[model samples]
Target: MPDAIWQKSSYSAANNECVEVRADAEAVELRESDAPGLVLKADPSVFADLLRTIKAGELDHHA
Candidate 1:
């Protein structure tokens, strides 16, 4: 992921703490602003499914 251009989520405020993402022809990468050295990579379809699941709130645990 060298020289990868990361984009921060719009939901984040004007702060350094945020979730960043980068996508290339091979896969999509995700990382936290606070921890740039750590990254998570996933296939395009898998990442899309993850986004869809999140939007659907399938991972929500609030009572």
Candidate 2:
């Protein structure tokens, strides 16, 4: 995804240390703003499920 047009969230940090996302015909991709070399790619539906889970706080750390 070297040539991918990554989009940063409008709610992200002003300093630019946040997640970026992009999508194409084959997959949706994610990468950290400060670590663009690494990316995570997933099927669009899977990404949607991930977003839902996140919004539901299923992945939140508990202490």
Candidate 3:
């Protein structure tokens, strides 16, 4: 995590209604912008797959 650079989502606005992400060599870190103290980590590959599923609308819950 030494060289991880945290970035907020592109859709996030000045009101801060999104999470921040940091990617290191091994894993990706995620934390709410309004609550930086709470962090979540996941494998980079798994994270990428989740993002793809989201973009493809494969995990939508509502019609």
Best by TM-score: 1
Error of 1 at 27 (Å): 0.5
Q: Is candidate 1 or candidate 2 better by lDDT?
A: 1
- Model 1 clash pairs are none
Residue-level lDDT tens digits of model 3 in 1-63: 857778999989889878899997699999999898899999999999989989999989865
lDDT of candidates 1 onward, in order? 0.90, 0.89, 0.89
Sort the candidates on lDDT, descending order.
1, 2, 3
How high is each candidate's TM-score?
Answer: 0.84, 0.80, 0.83
lDDT of 2 by residue, 1-63 (tens): 457788998889989999999998789999899998888999999999999989999888852
Ordered list by TM-score, greatest first: 1, 3, 2
Q: What's model 1's lDDT at 8?
A: 96
Kindly report the root-mean-square deviation of model 3 from the true structure over all alpha carbons. 1.8
The digit string of per-residue lDDT tens for model 1 on 1-63 reads: 577789999988787899999998789999999998899999999999999988899889753
Error of 3 at 9 (Å): 0.8
Which stretches in model 2 have alpha-carbon errors above 4 Å? 1-4, 61-63
Task: Give the range of the ten consecutive residues with the poorest summed lDDT in model 3.
Answer: 2-11
